[model samples]
Target: MAVARSRSSAGPVGYAVGDITSLDFPDGHFDGVRCERVLQHVREPDAAIKELIRVTRPRGRVCVIDTDWSSSVANGFDHLDEDIAEFFPEDNDPAAGRAIRSRMVRAGLRHTTALPVALRFTSLTDAGVVVPFFNCGAMQSRVRAELIERFFASVERSVDRGGLLFAFTMWIGLGQVPLGSMPRNVS
Candidate 1:
């Protein structure tokens, strides 16, 4: 953070890294907040969302964006989806993205909305820019060696056939804090 601040041209910037489940700021401090791609790794995503609401002022907006790995697909390869899902790191929630809006609604945030976005890639080289699985070594989960070989071979075939297609859904969820309301059970 210090490195970023030093390199930045903006003046008088402040940076604080606090626990998402329990923010350090006072209640209703900010006009808007955005938590992006962080909830999937959280042990209690709901609590984190509530904390975001707690720190947002009334009529403020909170946006949460996350990826649902279960929605990942690589067409032209039969085992691609299975491989990606099975080999994905367990610490991240594969279904967390799709659930963000529903969790916000359950937290009593008004004017809730969910937007589903699909990211598509047709080549391994291009896909590697965003999806790390294409590079193989970036995988954190344990997968069978033979399966990896087969997966790569299939990918090669797909690439040769000019049919490689990879896509996954990432959700953008939004909600507005109600007038004079705090998230239930949140201070």
Candidate 2:
């Protein structure tokens, strides 16, 4: 956030650290709202989406981008992937990305669209940035060190043979707030 605040030159653009599920803004405060890669980490993603819709003006756009960790796939590593898939939700909301569009519609947003983007990784170093299993150094307390080490050992071997290929889907959901006003608490 400090980096973002430093790099952004637009004076009208303001940044504040606040809760997503319960923002401090009033209704129809912003023309448009966007949330990126945040829902999957929150305790109540639907509430966050509702809050996003609540703050945007009628007919304004709201966009949410998040990862569908369930869509993760690794070439020649299906077993390991399955193990992690079950384990991921113990720590994060792995299905948040795929659920965004429907949630928006359910929250009364119109013209909702969801687009899936495949993020492919060929090297362990690059995949480690986003894929938790690939980063052994992170979340050492939450994840079993032995499992991560074993997985990375296999990944390293596969990479040495030039066969490590993994990918996951990220979804971008966009919608417009309904032109007709409804009670903010209804959604």
> Model 2 TM-score?
0.85
Summarize candidate 1's per-residue lDDT along 1-187 as a digit string, tens digits. 8887888887876789888998888889899999988887787888899999999999999999998878887688666766766655666686799999999998879999999999999989888767756767755355677777888888889999989999999999999999988764354
Put down candidate 2 lDDT per residue, 1-187, tens digits, no spaces: 9999889997677889998988888999999998998988887787888899999999999999999977887884434654465455564687789999999998889999999999999988898898766777664645666666677778888988899999889999999999877427433
The top-ranked prediction according to TM-score is: 2
lDDT of each: 0.84, 0.83
| CA deviation > 4 Å runs, candidate 2 | 6-12, 77-79, 82-92, 182-187
State model 1's lDDT: 0.84
